[model samples]
Target: MENTTETTKLLVSDRCDVCGAQAYMRVQLAGGELLFCAHHGNANKAKLEPITLEWHDQSSDLNQA
Candidate 1:
């Protein structure tokens, strides 16, 4: 058995690469990491999903207080 843990997380300070909004998703690819806000994430999902290694989504956290 093996144990694995998440090494990176998208923080409030992290901004979307496209829009400069607070990032809620972090996409890991061969090139590098791409941070995205909810809007941009959904817009590019079709293209990124195939090549993404990790999709670190934290949008649900927005509802938390």
Candidate 2:
């Protein structure tokens, strides 16, 4: 497994990697970390892999269940 704890530093610190806007979702992958503004996260989810880690704050869609 990759050290996402360390990779977190390499990911965008403040803004979304896709649109460079305020990030509403944080996409943590095995090999890379990504910060996505709500638009991009929901927009590109078809390409983003789902994660198993516990996210303190998660997308409302999941919380609905």
Candidate 3:
């Protein structure tokens, strides 16, 4: 199935997907998945719609950690 929802389109980086706060020195896997903090990621999501490919979701815990 193809994901058309803005929530699913954005690809999670191997870095900090939460809060979009990536550290200079960190650890991440190829697909381990990076998660974002709900408060930050979803807070300004509406404004990011146009430029972002993701809807910004942190409702559920990501498997990265």
Candidate 4:
């Protein structure tokens, strides 16, 4: 069996579930997924990481020119 993973990039249209800012991270929980901006993502990391199944962070893209 071959293991394959599909990666999806966060689009500019994706907004944070909290403040509506541009989303830079995607947090996947068993129930569903949450989109977060850098601020909320960092702030909630401690509380959410434990329950998150997948954390797709693209905050580094902010540093790119």
Q: Provide TM-scores for the models.
A: 0.83, 0.55, 0.33, 0.87
Q: Judge candidate 4 at residue 61 and give its lDDT.
A: 89
User: For model 3, how does the per-residue alpha-carbon lDDT over 8-55 read when each residue is reduced to its tens digit?
Assistant: 433445234444553211212343433445555455455554555323
* Best candidate, lDDT: 4
TM-score of 1: 0.83
Off by over 4 Å in 4: 1-6
- Over 19-59, each residue of candidate 1 has an lDDT whose tens digit, in order, gives 99999988989899899998899899999999999888878
After TM-score superposition, what is the CA distance of residue 57 in candidate 4 from its true location, in Å?
0.5
lDDT of 4 by residue, 12-43 (tens): 99999999999999999999999999999999
Q: Which candidate ranks first by TM-score, i.e. highest?
A: 4
lDDT by residue for model 2 (1-65), tens: 89764443322356778879756566666766677666787786766656523221234433444
| Regions of candidate 1 where Cα sits further than 4 Å from its true position | 1-6
Q: For candidate 4, give the lDDT.
A: 0.90
Better of 1 and 4 by TM-score: 4
* CA lDDT of each prediction against the hidden true structure: 0.85, 0.57, 0.41, 0.90
Candidate 4 pairs with clashing backbones: none
Stretches of candidate 3 exceeding 4 Å from the true structure: 1-35, 55-58, 62-65
Query: What TM-score, to 2 decimals, does candidate 4 have?
Result: 0.87
